[model samples]
Target: MGDWYSAEYPSSSLHSLQGYRVFISIAMILGDGLYNFVKVLGRTIFGLYNQIRDKNSRSVLPVGGRTSSPTDSLSYDDQRRTQLFLKDQIPIWVATVGYITIAIISTATLPHVFPPLKWYYIVVIYIFAPILAFCNAYGCGLTDFSLASTYGTLAIFDFKTGYMTLASPRSMFVSQIIGTTMGCVISPCVFWLFYKAFHDLGVPGSQYSAPYALVFRNMAILGVEGLSSLPKNCLTLCYVFFVGAVVINGIRDIVGKKWARFIPLPMAMAIPFYIGAYFTIDMCIGSLILFIWEKIDKAKADAFGPAVASGLICGDGIWTLPSSILALAGVNPPICLKFLSRKTNARVDAFLAS
Candidate 1:
């Protein structure tokens, strides 16, 4: 099933996701994506039709030139004007359009650098990444739990915004640009050093397995080819999920939010498919810690819960840098403890006794 797009790459070079669950997730993504595409297409066609119809029906105005508001943008429920040093802040619409422009350019040009990631695939990611990022950001704001990719999982704090705690978007944008500039220079140097040390990727028993690269590569392969290129029944599952997404949304609309409150979000529903069994345990433990803290002292938890959570997340990430250095030095933890399944534990015990 590997590399159905071309015969040049053997099975070893282009690894296909043959595992049942992983294959299903691929199907789900494909199916849901197709549904979204259809919806967008329909809406675009309808909008164009309305514009043509409106132009044909509307009467010509006199020289007096009296009309309604020129702008038809949706009004926000909470409209609060923000200022930076007595000047009005840049509008959200301006930022959004600017983002789209930059993203389009990046999508169009990125394939020149990474051939596996075709322009169309990049386009699709650009279209949906914002929605996914919004879901992750909103969920993090509510629960302090980030779901999805590493970037998605980041619960960035703004001192001004407070929980988010909110920062000025313009300032955030400027800071991000600076950070990205640094990362652009730093990341390649770090990777080159790792490459020099490791020699090659996908080395068996190598400390740096680079699973993220493998996952993205598989995605790119599927995107370049098609769902049919994947393992058998995956395409069928993709079809099922696509229809299922539409039907589920229809049901939610009919039932209404009060009744549909129990229904998990599309993003939340994907967690089981994407996450491992052990991740659920970690989530539960984290939830329990916060719950207990809140119960013990409501005031302190309200004030310090976010700070503590932020510290824990930052600490874990910062620890990795030192850990990687230690690992490269061939230093292992003195006591390496692990939890194993009952069957695996029994086998290890039996072997040790033998």
Candidate 2:
């Protein structure tokens, strides 16, 4: 999804528009299709196997107060209602037609938002949309993995190589946006997976950190401008630091678990270079507290620690929404801590004099 958004922004026409459109369309279809097919096949086979296994197990059990039978499982009214619901469900063809109409409208009315639509692009989308939807649903049902961003990245890279003539910065950007938008539309997995992963974990979407966005933005700028844009000394230092970090991590891994604890994590050492010291300090403090708690009572820490950590995270995130609204309205929240208060004796005296 990020890949697609990145490609479309500040568009440059380095690549063939038609070639990119087809490439993105086909890549999205295949990647999503394969994922879905595997998921559905696995689920159906396993589901049937489980049903059979359960039936066999139940049959062998001695007749008890409660018997496992079709009649006992669901009442006639319940089964009838289910059948009616299925029968009344919207027809596949009708839904497909409606979706296609919406796509056509979107392409026609929102040309600036969407890429220029060719007949082939529309055809490819219509043809593969069902397949993508099935795959997304199946994959999500099984593992809750959304392939939108993953496949979008593949599409952009594939276009860069396969349609080199059309792979200009502008063309790639448009292709990415189109592919990502289509993927999000086709895949229900993206929405459900986000809900399950974040909401269920009590993590607010606003508070979710996107470190990769920063990396990608920098990479994109470097790709366009070339390495000469960066100072040679700074570039050399980056190379040295990267290599040094890798070597240290390698040694730490080889030294095994006991010695690994004493060695500083390469990521921990490098994070302060990119992130603010204040944030790094907070994380280090939290990690140290967790490490100490785990050492003292491993079992209790293992069981209850996650919940406590989640509460702290949620507390930080939950207040952000109202705080942001208040800030936007030019009303800052009061600072309750005296040490942090900006009001001084001089200010109080001046106010009294006034």
Candidate 3:
């Protein structure tokens, strides 16, 4: 056994270094870094599209009978062309180059590596990403789309506050960081508990409400129940709150001309609720169908497993990514959705059917 001790293995005696462990760590770092790139890249492209459309519409307006100033015409053409090139081509080019660079650097550096450029990449995103987005929004000429200021809010929130705020710069980057980090930390523990419970109880997606019902049922047994029995319209309260946030933020953005003040708080509250509810409903409905299928035929369930599993890709498709990123930047979900529908509702419907 002492002969097994080799200089190749970093572990000397009892703490034997495992090649598998080292490989796994390297894989994880690469995966995480790529994930970060995808998140930023998707948002950047979405905003770029918004800007191009804005510019296109303005260009179509007749140069009018009014004599155009040489400087004004030149300025408009330059801005318009830049918007088109940025959206139609540039982002993908930059992303491809960036990814290639990362892969090459990581491969060359290997185990004893330094990922020093992570912050540099983030700073580039924080600075130019929003500026690009704002240009897109401005060129698009959508009165409601406020990417510039909102992107600014996101940058400030990410670099400064790390997105802890509830109202300002809704900071989806911050939320995503929190969610992914939490998911990483908690997924294993949750998975273990869920697996054990699921195996024993044979709980299915249709039975999601069962968990909530079970909790309340247990509470009632101990007479510990309080507001659960209340008939008050909780959803209605939520609706009211939603409207208030939307209107106030709109007023702030438009009338008050205070984009910073209005955009952050209301958007922070509104976005997650809206988009979260959308995906939550989709998951719940999908889960119910899976449970029903399981009851109908176990063999079909086995065969259909991959189909159901594939549903997750839809959740992360081109559509959902942009929607989330814009929301975090304090841009409203509906506006972004309308501006760029991505995979389309029909595709989403098909995914669910599968």
Model 1 lDDT-worst window of ten: 77-86
How do the residues 57-83 of candidate 2 rate in per-residue lDDT, one tens digit apiece? Answer: 655656777646564576564455444
TM-score of 3: 0.20
Q: What is the overall TM-score of model 1 with all chains considered together?
A: 0.60
Ranking by lDDT: 1, 2, 3
* Count of residue pairs whose backbone atoms collide, per candidate: 5, 12, 6
* TM-score leaderboard ranking: 1, 2, 3
Please, what are the lDDT tens digits per residue for candidate 3 over residues 1-354? 124333443321111222222222223222322333455678899989988987766665567686775546554534454444333332556656875676556555543454644545554554555444433333222112222321111221121122112222224344656877877878797557555544443342332223423323433432444433222343244345545644554465465554554353443332223223454455556657777888999777756554454555345455745754554455644533322246567787788899
Q: Name model 3 segments beyond 4 Å from true.
A: 1-231, 259-264, 270-354
Best by TM-score: 1
- TM-score, every prediction: 0.60, 0.36, 0.20
User: How well is each residue in 208-289 modelled by candidate 1, as lDDT tens digits?
Assistant: 7665555557667766787556655555665676567657655765799898866644434444455555555655677689
